[model samples]
Structures are given as structure tokens and as C-alpha cells.
Target: MILTDTHTHLYSEAFDKDRDEVIRRAVDNGIERFFIPAIDSTYTQAMMDLESDYPENIFLMAGLHPTHVKEDYKRELKHVEQQLKERKFHAVGEIGIDLYWDKTFLRQQQEAFRLQIQWAKEYRLPIVIHCRESFDEIIEILESEKGDDLFGIFHCFTGNLEQAKTAISYNMKLGIGGVVTFKNGKIDGFLDQIDLRHIVLETDSPYLAPVPYRGKRNESAYLINVLEKLSDVYGRSKEDIAKITTENSKEVFGV
Candidate 1:
């Protein structure tokens, strides 16, 4: 069965010592596709190098992450624009408001988010959102910009049923990840109520590792743990879940 990890930072330094082995582990476990999200201009070269190393499996995205928004955000956005003009990317993402860590750049974050959404529409590409402690703010902007051209995945979604429905209303697929396997990760409670077509799997790896691996560094191969949890949550076979979620990912990323 082929599985898609719609959001993962394979270029992250966390896997610097054994990046190839990490990728091989995932591929051997049937998780072939890895969608890499952009954080800032600093990681652009590393991301390119990753794609260069594994062109068949790596898909790139260009955008300034909300947390990275700062006084020099304008220059960063320019870099994103230049990258888009120079080549191809499957999406513009891992962008949105993140108020959890620091609210100092709240206004800048909102502006960056809106500008990136406009860019996504201009390029006719999907957006992968990174939302944290700002669901209301995120939904408000999405409401103002809602339309046919605005569509993507809500990466690492950790909201309630109403928020999930709201995200779906905006043409976004819920990106389920290792959190679903956590005993207290509430999304699992109501996930089955939402149709499988609106869900996609992700690891956000080197980050939210699934149970049996929780509290440790995450990897794409652990996506199997997530798949197994989803299978139990939705009462479907693991292969079926893989097929449906991977198909859902294709619909969002257009790959």
C-alpha cells in the first residue's frame, strides 16, 4: 500500500545524521511520498538538496512560516515569490498564524498569511497551513478570502468538530498525524464522524511522533502507527485507509 505524508520536514536538521536511512525506512514501509514545507529562506537550500537527493519522493513548497514572521518578513516574502517564479512547487504552505510561542508578530503574521494565500491563488496551487492557538484568527482570514481558488490542507489540525467542519468548508482536507494516536489527542474522538474523503495523513516528523514512539523524535516510517490508529478509528482496513488518504492528498496537492 502506498501512503502519503502530506506534511513533513525531511530537510530538518533532526535527521542530519541519518537522513537517507530515515527515508529508506519510510519507503521500505510503503510511505513513498513526502511533502516538504518551507519555514524560511534559510532552509531553502537544504530543502532543494533534499529534493535533489530524492527527486522521486520529495515535493517542495515555498512560503514563510508564521512563527518565522519578523521585522524582515517582507524580504522573506520576496524570496518566496522569487522561488515560485524560478521553479515549481506543489504548494505554498506551512503558513498561517501561530500565537502559541510569541504574539509579538501577530499583525505581521496575519499579513504574511494573507499575502501567501493570494500568492497561492495566483499560482493555482494548494496551501498547507500550520495553525496553532489561533483557530479563530485563521478562520477569520479564511472567511474573508474564501473562494474557488483557495484550497489546501490544514496541517496538524487540532481543533474541535466545529473547527474541522469550518476548515472543510474552505476546501481544506484535515491533515491527521501522530496526534491521532495519542490517548488524549481529542481529534480521534470525532474523526470517524468526518468522512474519510476529507482526511489526509501526515507525520510532521521529527516532531509529533505517534504512540509507542511518542516523546521521541518522529520519522515518516512511524506513519504506519498513525495508519493503524486511523484504521481502528474509522473501522476500515489499514490498506483501505492508506488508499483513501493518499487519494485525498492527491486531490489537494494535485500530484
Candidate 2:
């Protein structure tokens, strides 16, 4: 069974001490494919360090995260462009509207999101989005900016059925993570409605850890919990869920 962590910030400081061990443990347990998302220029060096350490198992994505969109967003975007020109990334990602924290820079966030989406289109690469309490607003931008080439994952998808369908219409795959394992993380009841083709597995590690590890730091090995929960929801075995989601990820990342 091939399992893919389509979205994870292995570059985060949370894993500085045991990052290699965490990845090694996950790989031993069959969580091989890890697609890393870029936050801002702040973590570019850490990301490069991680990719250098694990070149075969890890892939990188470049973009400015929405929450990181501040007064100097233009410079941050320039940094993103600079990195893109210097290296090849699997996608332009972890970019989208994040209105959950503060609504101060909503306009800037939208602008950055649109611009990054345009970059993804230009590079012929998929994108990974981080939508937080801004699905309606995001839909508006996607409707306007999304073209034939715009495609990627809706990282940490917890949206409703209609939202899922709408994102699908925009060629976005739902990045399923630990939320599905939460007692109150309500996507499971309707997840069966979403075909496996539009879904991919992710851990979003050191953040939304699955049940059992809920409230603690998440890791790639804990992806087994997400996969197990998915099997229960889809009425399939863990191996089957792993195979299908891995294939679906390959379809999106083309790896």
C-alpha cells in the first residue's frame, strides 16, 4: 500500500529535533511520499535543508501562505518568484484565503492567492490551498481566476458537500487529514459522497494530529490513523484506501 502525505510542513521548527526520525518512522510504516508546502521566505532555508536531506522521498512547493500576507506581501511574493526561478518545485502551494485568524488583510490575501494561482497556471503545475473560514470568498476568486490549467489540493478540507463539489468544479482535490478522525470533525458523514478520485491523504503534521494523537504534535506515521479512519468511513481496507489515495495523489502531483 502506497500512502502519500500530500501536504505537510516538515520544515517547521516543531520537527527540528526529530524531523529525520519522524520521517524515517513514517517511511518504515509505508508513508513514503511527502509533498512539502512553503509558508513564506522565512522557512525557505529550512525547506531546502529538508529536501537536501531527503531528496528521494520529499518534494517541494513554492508560494506565500495567506496568513503570512502582511504589509510587505509584495516582497514576500518576490521571494517566492525568486525561489521558483532558482529551483524546480512540484507545485505553487499552501496558498489561499485564511480569514479565521484576522480579517485585516483580506484583500491582500485574496490578491496574493490570485497571483499565486496565476503562477501555478504559468508554470503548468498544480497548487495546494489553505482555506480557513473563507470558502465563499475563495470560491469567488477561484471562479474568476481559475482557468484550464489551475488545479491542486484544498489542503485540510473540512468544507461541506456543496463546497467540495464547487472546489471540484474548479479542479481542486480535497486534502483529507486528521480532521476526519475528530469526533466533531463533520466531514465523514458526507465524505462517501466524494469519490476517491477527488481525494488525497495528508497529515498536516505537528498540527492537526489524528485521534489518539489528537492535541499532540502530528507526524507522518500518524497518517495510519487517518487512513484507518478513512477505511472505516469508505467501508474499505487500509491497504485499499492507501492505494487509491496514493494513485489520486500521483494524478495530482504527476509523480
Q: What is the C-alpha lDDT of each candidate?
A: 0.96, 0.92
lDDT by residue for model 2 (134-187), tens: 999999988998777989999999988998999999999999999999989999
Query: For candidate 1, what is the lDDT?
Result: 0.96
C-alpha displacement of 65 in model 1, angstroms? 0.6
RMSD of each: 0.5, 0.8
The estimated TM-scores of all candidates read 0.99, 0.98
> Candidate 1, residue 1: CA error in Å?
0.4
lDDT of 2 at 47: 90
What TM-score does candidate 1 reach? Answer: 0.99
Clashes of 1: 0
**Over the stretch 18-71, how does candidate 1's per-residue lDDT look in tens digits?**
999999999999999999999999999999999999999999999999999999
**Which residue runs does candidate 2 get wrong by more than 4 Å?**
none
- Residue pairs with backbone atoms closer than 3 Å in model 1 (clashes): none
